[model samples]
Target: MNDFDALQAVIRRLAAERQAEQRACEAFLNALYHALRTASGPGLPLNNVTFDFTPDPAERLRPPPPGGWHAAWLRLGLCEVLVRVRRDEGAFVGEYGEGGTFHLTGVTEDDLILLARRLLRDVAAAYGGGGLVGRSGMPLN
Candidate 1:
């Protein structure tokens, strides 16, 4: 193709790719909402469900905010490996994992402290389901 034609072709291709990515992001987010829903007030449910996510335009289509609940889940999920329990619900649901459904119940002051401490080391890994889990035994620092 001529030089001008080649440049035009490249520009067209780039535009097409960007459009595809935008559509994909939208579809994926929509599907995600229909999959992991929150059932209760002011929190995401650990139960399998669906939810609608209205992304913020100012953030350039970034996903919803990572609230405190999500942060808590990262902590508990990491500790879960060492504790040997069921799958971490809060990770997906965005709320405090149900203590009744698992070992850690009764969100007491001490429990919160322990969870925060455990997650501190491995929060970066926690995002994509990868993270370090502290040992089960309390060594007494």
Candidate 2:
């Protein structure tokens, strides 16, 4: 094949791979959302959770990079938790922190889920009840 043809072939393959990766990431996010909601029970305070798939403008012209970032937020009582995911050298890396005070990094999905569950449980215990009043002055149950 000519050089131009070879480059085109590479682009096609990259596009296909990027599409598949996006789909997989979406599926994983969906599963994680459901799991968090289920674990929350009664009222879902995570309604505002969203996923951003748009690539940065600078990165848009070329094929999608191998590693990128994914993030979501959760509110537990007055505490705000930031959950982040990224592809690091062919591996999935997860991290979570609360108000920038406490952070746990380099965790897997399972570990992150477990930590979230524990955080919820601990917050509930600390509040002496199951519901927590959020920053909006509303109880998140």
Best candidate according to lDDT: 2
Please, what are the lDDT tens digits per residue for candidate 1 over residues 25-140? 44433433322232122364434332333333223322222221111111122233111111133222212222111234334445434443443334334544453443654321
**Model 1 residue 31 lDDT?**
35
Per-prediction TM-score: 0.25, 0.43
Candidate 1: regions farther than 4 A off: 1-11, 38-141
lDDT of each: 0.34, 0.51
Root-mean-square deviation of every model: 14.9, 9.5
With candidate 1 superimposed using the best TM-score fit, by how many Å does residue 97's alpha carbon deviate from the native? 16
Global CA lDDT computed for model 1: 0.34
Please write out the lDDT profile of model 2 over residues 1-141, one tens digit for every residue.
999999888778687666665555445545555555545544654554443433333344444544544555555445555555545554455544422112334345564465556546545544575454444655554
Worst 10 residues of 2 by lDDT: 98-107
